[model samples]
Target: MNHRSLFRRLLLAAAAALPFALSVGDAAAQAALPSDRVLRVVPHADLRTLDPVAVSVTITRMHGLMIYETLFAWDSQLRPQPQMVESTTTSSDGLTWRFTLREGLRFHDGQPVTTRDVIASLRRWMARDVVGNHLGARVTALEATDARSFEMRLSRPHGFVTYALGSAVGQIPAIMRAEDAETDPSRPITTTIGSGPFRFNRDLWLSGQRVVYDRNPDYVPRREPADGLAGGRVVRVDRVEWQIMPDAATAAAALQTGEIDIWEQPALDLVPVLSRRRDIQVDRLNTISTQAMLRPNSLFPPFNDPRARLALAYATDQAEAMAGGWGDERWWRRCEAYFVCGAPFGTEAGAEGYARPNLDRARELLREAGYNGERIVFITSTDIAPIGRMAEVAAASLRRIGMNIDLQVNDWGTVITRQPRRDPPDQGGWNLFVTFASGPTMQHPLTNIGTNMACDGRNWSGWPCDEEAERLRNAVLDAPEGPERIRLLDALHRRLAETQPYRVLGQVDQPYARRSSVRGMLNAPVMVFWNIEKSAR
Candidate 1:
């Protein structure tokens, strides 16, 4: 057999061998299992690193969340809720944050969670390797005043610090005490201790395949009693089995065949089919942002010009792309901004400049630049199935506009290999590409802009007017969350919208398929499992 075929066989063999090592089927079938309801997630990417600091990918974030706890968590509506913290108060200057640690909380190991542990965990994540994806430097300092009182001082005011914790930068897996990890900054914590309802158990089959989490007998959220499953409080599942069957077809078949109990985030195409099944519960949700974006770096030419980017946007067929990516009629809600379009934030700003299928405009702009269909490279992840499908359709759409499109679909590993590196590396391994959330703080305001949109922005798209964008971003940050704050952000969104910093192509319509027993669906956009404990059968 050829090398490719041999590799495929080896992979399949390895996957088959994994279940046997842990006797997964037996463990899953045990009636005594806490998680009689296992949630099987079929996503485009696998959870690679469990070290929270190293984890920023969406897939890893979702899975990592079940085993870790952050300072704060979110409800479906995007409001901040306390998870590990009893209350978080910001100083008037907004430079320091004082958090009251939730009492009676214990990591899976039965060690009580203290302010020291919280500070230590954050410190580890603050190390250059972890938060580096968003922040340039770690926190200036972390001080635990007492056993349960802690204060963090940011180099500058970061109004949305909690949002960052809840998002991608939450703890990475490997259940050890944070104190230990913090002591050795260079050593990555493969295991960790967490105060979540679920405790990590090593008897599981595979690393990313089937991780089994048993109910933490010690898991008692101070505010919410664990007994009230109907109230939708802490974790209810006695055990949680995370089976990584990356293929949607396989996951669906497993659901139908009774091999799995639930699917965390199913393929967009299966929403209808699964929704129609009365035996299963299909929980649907409206998230904050779902649009697949194209990052044409304007820092360099062709892309640097707003007019050029707008022309490119006008040239492509967004509707067609979304349809293909989402599977026929199953795409996400379209959006025009990083915040949900039509959301409070979206309404104040974000109108016009999508360039939506105006072929004539695209032709006109291209002619203005020098008429030619030279090949432009587009980079994306194969693990991101939607983007993969979208890229294929996008290439076709651009081709019709006389743009010779060379789309490169690489592994998620390779796609992000050089992502953290300076763009234009090796003469820019890519040109135009699609990217997702820079982070909660990336919109404007230097603090925010640097999170996602800075030219040095981790997801930078080679835009030239980055300096100008940064200025607007800084202005928005200066404006807090008030009428004036809204106006400032609105103006920044409008500026970026006009510049096509990144097209807010659409917001993903997140759907969770579980047993009829589950509720608490409308949580925040990250799709974390913090509140799932209260959702009952």
Candidate 2:
């Protein structure tokens, strides 16, 4: 049977076994916290790292949103709005900007937040985040003007200063304590202290099993109501517990029995079963589509050759890949646009021949690249259902095009940790991996980590180095938002097509399932526990 059929069979079997699974011992019940005061959720992945600046993974980013706060945040309209900053001023030349912190901001350790902490946090974030790096390049100086204020002097007029600081995608600009922010950007900080509405319970953190957060009573939320990731972050629940459940059936059963309040990303195949129940509400919190891609390591052989990368692109069938993993066509669509389909910059500039599958052409390209059956190591996360399915589909497609594939499966945490290694495939390196990001994150060239083809190794994990692509991307960034910018974006898209930095598999909308009792959930790209209340069932 085909992968889609196999997935359907497995899902049906799981649904049939749901009744038996409900008898299993409950992990959340063991906690002493009151059910009404606690909001239990099955997170997308385990919280392996606490330092958000060091890792760009989604789970860590979500964790940071709970305990940390940013100077500014993206509102529902995707506009930058002040979160931590009370007031701001800009020089007439637009080369310098000053910001004053809001009053009553204190870290979880009971220390007042100051400008020094903001400076240190931004400095550390600048060394790691893609957008932060761009902001750092134009910044001449970032100094604390007073105990509660800071100023950033730019070498040139930067248009997206606030946007970069308030970005809701990828690695967020989470403000940290001065001492904790002093930690090297390359190393993960153990300290979890932050000034957000929730405090991470480090004592209750059980690595791969459970992660807990307590509401911070001392948090001073903005007066405005919650909008996206901006405005007031009111914590209604006394505690938020992220209970990790790798199995989709077990998680579904838990949600059914009221053992869990929410399942962040439910398996698409089982959505029908969950939706049939009135007690469970399946909602697509993020309206924007999530773009899935196959990232190939350009630093290694096979994919190192642009021709080989093109071969994989030609071999990929967007429709087949989407159906294999995402199942329902209602949630996924074939999108060849590298900048995300339906976005303003989204275009099929040069994706005519390669976007659709051409097995004969793929074989020809592989032969031209002089591939001699070298094993291509493809790492996948079994914990994330779609990722594993995408990897399986991609591996099968590569094999049909005569590529030797070595598929390795691991949990989401392990996959993320191993993705950074630049060693050879035999020495813990990976040739390809399947992952997805929100459309907002992939919409703009600057915010799109996949489009960052900087020759420096500091780019995204794939390490795709293309001078021409880099030049085109920089041109797009510099061009004003109009015909000129659109022209440059088209050029960049065409160049990326030729270089094949990464292959866009498809676009999908993954919904979150929650018990009807879980109320006040915000609709943002990343999950936020704040502004959520666990009503008595």
Candidate 3:
């Protein structure tokens, strides 16, 4: 078959298998509608896990925001603002800090929000999140002074404590009930009770098929205007339902037929088709753009060698990958810099080495590294549009460099489950996978989960260990918010180029579609479901 024919076949197969991929029931569930006040959305992924604190997936974070509250949140300007906290005071020595909870806060279970709950939630979050862990290491004590007040006694001064707690980047510090927060951070919390604007309808959640949320009438929202992940979380709608439609074509058709009000991340190939519809409104969801990535496992052989990693990196063609993943070059840009282009630390300073593909160099490196004919397990989730295409592009690039590939296809949830396995490739472990993240997350060292060099084999999916990079990341955090911080971040980027833990497959602008009647969408870094209202046709 020709390349175009193959591409069409792949796209069609993905679409045909999607509607039934994660379904346990018949089409009757898709036809079920609660009421006119219900807002139906087709999310990028099905809600696989309910524990937002345990995992940092985009869909889980959205669900967390719907049910859980945070102490602080980021505004549109990226400034940290108080959300659950009514006031905070810091001592001159910076070693002591105090926070008072806002009045009239009540969890879905009717329990008043308390300082003990906040302390437990922070402890649970600090155990998992990188930023939280760093901050936790500096703290001498975390104590609750009263029913609504808490204090933190640190060993030294820390400037980014508030930002770390308020950040929505990865595994946000979502506040939960004290009992739920006391659960082990390594395990998922089954309970979903919080003081957010919306309450999770656990009785109606159908795992990988559908999830529902109802407006919390008793929950109190901030009086301030909504901005990004901060300010008021007013709920104008009575209900929000997320229906899992993995097929791009199916989701676009649903939007056109008015079966769904919003499609969070539409396939790039079908954007034009959706845009031509009069009732559909396609808008750029994330202005920072999405950074495509090729992650390789450093725990196993073949990829365990930096030379082997460099071989694959040399074989990577950002333009080819972007074209295959997101057709129409206008929708994507070739960003070779690992720190993302247009950010403060984003520069071409030391990225001249990774400008273009070098198949000859790749082969030479592979041979020098004594690469045997072992299969490189390349994983792809056919159900996810961009991820499936990206996997194909990366696999093809590696094959061109004379590497053996064992292409594995599965659902997105399965990929997420297997990405963290430490076993060998033969025993359910993964050697490589293709995924993407928001540009804002990768722009800085502290917020960038990809820059983690924990070396403990438990870093981000593809565990990379570079003591130099880790030290530089600390330097970036310690330096004041000025040019010195920028210098430190750039230095870390240069070190990442040498380490080659992962490769940037370019950047793509993701467009979200909603009904024309829906309005007041926020253009924040992460998708905000607040301040959006739907009117009857």
Best by lDDT: 2
Q: Across residues 402-512, which tens digit of lDDT does each residue of candidate 3 receive?
A: 888999999888887787667888889988999888887777677777778866544567788888888887888888888888787778778778778788888888889
Evaluate model 3: give its TM-score. 0.92
Writing each residue's lDDT as its tens digit, candidate 1 over 1-537 gives 444553344345455444442454455356555443444333445555555555345555555565666666545444445666777788888778888876777777778877767666665654533233343242576788898888877777765577555443333322236566566654445674666666667665365456666667766654642221111246545666666666665666555444555676677666666666676777654434444666665554456566767776687666777776775554455555655454555542554555267888887887776647656777776566777777777778777777877777777656654443445523655666665542232222332221245554333324234566556666665566788877777677776666666655555555667655454443444554435532323
What are the models' TM-scores?
Answer: 0.75, 0.94, 0.92
Model 3 C-alpha lDDT versus the unseen true structure: 0.81
Q: Give the least accurate 10-residue stretch of model 2, judged by summed lDDT.
A: 17-26
Off by over 4 Å in 3: 1-36, 456-458
How high is the CA lDDT of each candidate model? 0.57, 0.86, 0.81
RMSD in order of candidates: 7.0, 3.2, 3.8
Candidate 3 — which pairs collide?
A: none
